[model samples]
Target: MQPVHIILLIVAYFSVLLFISYLTGKSANNKTFFKANNSSPWYLVAFGMIGASLSGVTFISVPGWVESQSMSYMQMVLGYIVGYAVIGLVLLPLYYRLNLTSIYTYLQDRFGNYSYKTGASFFLLSRTIGAAFRLFLVANVLQLLLFDAYGIPFWVTVSITILLIWLYTFKGGIKTIVWTDTLQTLFMLIAVGVCIYTISTEMQITNIFSYVAESELSKTFFFDDVKTGDYFWKRFLAGAFVAIVMTGLDQDMMQKNLTCKNLKDAQKNMFWFTIVLVIVNFFFLALGVLLTDYAQKNGIDAHKDQLFPIIATKGSLGLATAIFFLLGLIAAAYSSADSALTSLTTSFSIDILEIDKKKNPEEQEKTRKKIHILFSFVLIATILVFKYFIADQSVIAKIFTFAGYTYGPLLGLYAFGLFTKLQVKDKAVPFICIIAPVLTFLTNYSTIQYFNFDFEFFVLVINGVYSFLGLFLFKK
Candidate 1:
């Protein structure tokens, strides 16, 4: 755990990434920069997507979650499968049929310019915040590794780290992201696997199936009698909504999916993606259960998120295991950090700013580079602002929760356009979309406070309903 070792590991990782970036960026023109010339293999996109889907927030959060609530999150993972199915069958085809450069363009065609901008704006705001929060999670870990371990200043650590992501992704955009993300996913899965092995070995639970089954944490699904608060139905609904909004409806996630050669491949990729997600999440939760049991037995004190890292860094793990664990963590963060950067730029360019129509490929490429730089700065600012002003550890989570309000509108608007023939007034669409989420939040808040109603995982459901109602009210 020497500071220099951590620095060297980071440098080595960046050096290789830089080499990859230079190699890829060399031939990058507008098409290749934006969509990898639509030449990426669907399977590669699917594998690369794991890094994007899980990110640093998920990498740390999922494992940490196992230390509490008795490893209950597995209940939601089952629901996630159902959600992905809906996305593949219902959502992906719609996106592909439209042949969209930015999916929000569908809103414009279905409704009007106002609706398109509203949807794109919501995406911009939601994605900007979401990406910032995800990156902040990674930044926090890097800061600890730097200051607590190596005494580097927080600002310097944040700057240097983000700069590296910018350097690599500033040129090739989503094309480079597809390949880099695959690399990241490989690193990420390897990291998760190493943790599973280390924790199981330390517990002397040699048989993977028996260890997971015998351990109290191995309960993968829930059938709670209660109607809410992690109940089976609630968790399932929550998982479905999470998958739909976080994956299907999200540009950041779907942008990679859309890079496939054709919609058939994209659909195939989604199916395989869902299957892989299920297996991967199962392992994370199982690891959580194992880690929790081991800690309880060994009298270890650590936060739920810190539980895995602490054990791997300080526990009975051998040197090689420890190194792999660290590398995995770094890999997960970098994998996500780069994709977020790419997606933010893509959304901004296609959805809001209209970089797709620049006409001249050369100018389009230069404009993209400028936008990438702009977003990198915005992300750095977000991390700094959150670090200094936000005292609550829950603030970041709340930002995500609040940011989620926007997705309800996205879900409702998209569902309305695809499922029904009702025409909406172009001018009023944006207002309806905005008001829907606000009303949903108010209703949700009031229900929880006055009626003794607790909608733990169904917030997005409520959000969709409110948005739908608003659309109905404002329809032409």
Candidate 2:
């Protein structure tokens, strides 16, 4: 596909998103932006959460990841099922009962102001990095495939990426995202299915699941390897904790769930979301197997993050594959990026500034708009940093490794708050959370350097344990 054709496809895609934004953004206030006035359908929220949770990183990187990881990522997917159950049964009830816009508010009520602020601050930092990582992958791909053809610099591409998200998301916030994400998720899934079919046909694989099962690369369980990252126990447990903190405790994800009309609706959403997410992730892995085999047979040197993009856009797969690939890539990328932008704005405005407490609607909206624009630029700059320093490794691996530290504190804070009734010194709480991650990092470094036994996915569990122990020491 030509660069001009890609640009036109993008323009048409965002036009639909903007039209959805226009319809949803009318009369949207902080309440609508933050919670969609608690009127979103449960099914839409369930479906939309898939796109946000998977993001562009999964779309492009997960299949590419199979070269090294194989289907062992499924261990984490299984773990996610357990994690989502905890959210549905445990966390969702608490959030609904308390009527919270920001889940960090629970930290305040349970611990103290400092603890609440610490929790929210960790989420802000963690999410900013996470969102930046996702956008970096997609933006880099966009730069390679389209922008570079027109002599556009990477910085210009990154800026345009952020600006486009800000355009439709500045007003409606979660309201607009609730609908736009559903559309994007649909496009993303369709693209995956189409690509799988096209490649499977060329390879003459009649029964995909059977063929995937028969192949050597289709190994899903890794019980024999305890020292590696893909081991079942490590990945499964990490996957569980990851789902809990990154989804249940995350403002961007839970923000959408909170838009549902009631706790029951939200619980139902989580149930369906979990089922679909597992199936979807399996498909991504299977697609990875196919893409890898196709690349090998045809002698395409592409591997890791470059595999899918190189094969999909190359002339061999046909024009339809290229068209859907772009649509799917954009849909998957923006589905998460747009929501991250809105949630960061929501958290900063409500959690940091407490703007929702003000009486004037206009003032609150004004504050939100400014913060919205601020995060848009924040994401833009962060993506540029990733391009410069962090572009070599697969994007998904970086996200999970980073999550082990950034989100580990959140897992600890929430676990401490919910399971324990004892109070700790408010000022001491912040110090504990900060020190926990630092110590966890030191421990992780030592384990890998000296012990030669890398904790890998278990780092989150280890970090959570450190925070839990720290909180216990400080309990009154």
Q: Give the number of the best model, judged by lDDT.
A: 2
TM-score of model 1 relative to the true fold? 0.94
Give each prediction's root-mean-square deviation over alpha carbons: 2.1, 0.8
Per-prediction TM-score to the true structure, in the order listed: 0.94, 0.99
Full-model lDDT for every candidate: 0.77, 0.93
User: Which regions of candidate 1 deviate over 4 angstroms?
Assistant: 225-227, 388-400
Per-residue lDDT of candidate 2, residues 167-277 (tens digit): 999889999999999999999999999999999999999999998998888999899867677789999999999999999999999999999999999999999999999
Compared to the true structure, candidate 2 yields what TM-score?
0.99
lDDT of 1: 0.77
